[model samples]
Target: MEHVRPLPTYLAQRYHGWKATTFAENRAWYKRLADEGQRPRAMVISCCDSRVNVTSIFGADQGEFFIHRNIANLVPPYEPDGNQHGTSAAVEFAVTSLKVAHLIILGHSSCGGVAGCYDMCSGHAPDLEEKSSFVGRWMDLLRPGFERLPAEADETTRRRALEHEAVNVSLENLMTFPFVRSAVENGSLSLHGLWTDIGEGQLYSLGISGEGFAAV
Candidate 1:
C-alpha cells in the first residue's frame, strides 16, 4: 500500500484510451478552446467532490461549460485577496471574458463537507483549528448556516437544507462580482439553482421563483 502501481504509465494509457477517433474529435477541442477563446454560454459553480463531475452530469463537450468547483460548492462573499479571489476570479473570467449567460450553482446529497459542518455544529466534531488546517477554514464557510439552522432537524434533512442554503449563499455571492452583478441587473445573465441526489439518480427543483424543490 506504500508505493502503488505505475501511475504515470496508467495515466498515459488512459488518456490514449479516450473514445476519440479522428484527431479533430479530440485535439481540435483544445485548439477551439484556445482559439475560439472559450466563449462558453454557461457558468457552473459546483462541488469539488469527485463523485460529481460537472461536465459529465451536464453532458457537456469541450468549451460548453465554464466550471469552477470548490469544497462544499461554496462561494465566499467577495473579498479582495489582492490577487487570490479563487472563486471570485473564476466568476469574473466567466462573466467578463467568456461572457457566459447562465450561472448555475450545483449542490448534491451526501457532501462530506456539509456532514463535517453538521457534526461540528453538534459539538461531537473535534476542533482541528488548534493547528492551522484547510478543512477547518473550508468548514468555516458553512459556519453561518450551521449556527443558524434549526437544531431539531434530522441529519439527512439538515444536510439537504444545508445544500439548499449553500446554493443560495453562492448565488448571493455571485452578485458581489461587478461583472456578474451588471449582467444580472441588465438581464443578460440568469441564475439557476440545482441539487443532485446521487443515490436516487434524481434532481430536485428550486429556483429564483417559488417552485422550491420538486423532483426533476
Candidate 2:
C-alpha cells in the first residue's frame, strides 16, 4: 500500500476534464457499454509508440476497436508452451471469445523497437545480445525481417524497409496460430497489415501479393 500513489496532478486534471465534458456528454453511451460489455468489430495490434494513436487515426470511439500494443508491434510465432504469453492470450481472446471479424497489424515509421532490432541483428548492439535483456530477446522475432532486407540498401532505406517488415512478420506469424488460421480459413476473419509514415501522416497497406506496401 505504501508503494501505491495517486494519479499525477496533470493526469488527474485531464481525467476530471474528460469526465466533465466527454463522459458527461456521452453518459448514456458509457453506461450502456459498461452494462452490455464490449463487442469491438476489429482487433488492432500496433506499436507502443506514444505518437501512434490508433483511435484518432480511425476516428474510432469507445468499444469500436480492441487494441493491443507492443514493441514494434511484433507477434511471435505460435508457441503454446503454457507460459506467460500476453500477446498470444490477447489474440486468442480477440479471435476466439470476441470473434472479431478483422485482425490488423499496424506498423509505423521510426520505430525504436525496429531500430533496436536492426542494430542487434547487425551486431552493433552488444547489450541486446545478452541473455538477460528482455528487449533483446523480444526483438529477436524481427531478425528474419532484418535478414530479408536488401544487402545494398542504404541505412535510411533499410530502416523504412524494416518497419514494413515488422508488419509483414506479424501478419505471417498470426497465421501460425491454429485458431487464427481456422477463423481465416472459414472466412470469418481477415488479416491486414499497414504502415504509416509519422512525418508525412501517410499510410500504406500491404499488397494482396504480400510483396510490398502501397499508399492508401
Candidate 3:
C-alpha cells in the first residue's frame, strides 16, 4: 500500500478536463444527487474489461445505474459460508437493500477473462490450475457455461459461445440467492442477459426463452 504511485499526468489532466466540462455541466444535478441520495433503477454486473463502458453504452447519467464489474462478469452460486464474496455482496445489497428493478448480466466479445477461463478449463493454463490462483478460482464459476458448448465448434465460435454462456450462467446463479428469487417472484425485479461486440459496436440480448442472443 505504501508503494502506491500518484495518477499519471495524462489521466490527471483528463480528470481536470472532465471536472471542468462534464462535471461542471452537471453540477446542479450532482449536488442534488448528493443531497437526495441515489435510487438507481437497474444493477448491471459486467466484465472488468477496459473496453466495456457500462454508462456510455446506455447513455446513462450518474446515479442512474448501480454498476459492478468483475472478471468475465461471472456470479457464483449462492453461498453463505461466511467468506468474503465481493460480487455476492454487491448483488445482495442491490436486491435486498437498494431494491433495484432490474439485474442485468453484461458480457462482451474478446473478453480476456473469458479467454483465460477457456485456457484454464482446456488444460492449457497451468498457472491458473494451481489452487493459489485467485483468478483461476473466480473463473471456475464460468466452467459450466464453457462445458455446455459443442465440442465440434472452432475456438472462436466456442469462445463467443462461452461469453454468452457467462451471462446466462450468472442469471441462473443470481436466482439461487433467496432474496433475488423473492424479488423476481414478487414482480419487483427482472433479470437480463446481454452480450456486446466491442469492435463492431453491436449488442445482442438473450430472448425470453433463453434460447440464444438476438441482435438488439
**Which number leads on TM-score?**
2
CA deviation > 4 Å runs, candidate 1:
1-7, 19-30, 81-83, 209-211
lDDT of each: 0.79, 0.95, 0.94
Candidate ordering by TM-score (highest first): 2, 3, 1
Tens digits of lDDT, candidate 1, 177-197: 777788999999988888899
Alpha-carbon runs more than 4 Å astray in model 3: none
Highest-scoring model, lDDT: 2
Model 2: per-residue lDDT, tens digit, 56-147? 99999999999999999999999989889999999999999999999999999999999999999988999999999999999999999999
TM-score, each model?
0.86, 0.98, 0.97
lDDT of 3 by residue, 1-216 (tens): 999999999999999999999999989999999999999999999999999999999999899999999999989999999999999999999988899999999999999998999999999999998999999999999899988999999988998899999998999999899999999999999999999999999999999988799999
True lDDT of residue 49, candidate 3: 96
lDDT measured at residue 161 in model 1 versus the true structure, 0 to 100: 88
Worst 10 residues of 3 by lDDT: 138-147
Better of 1 and 2 by lDDT: 2
lDDT score, candidate 1: 0.79
Query: lDDT ranking from best to worst?
Result: 2, 3, 1
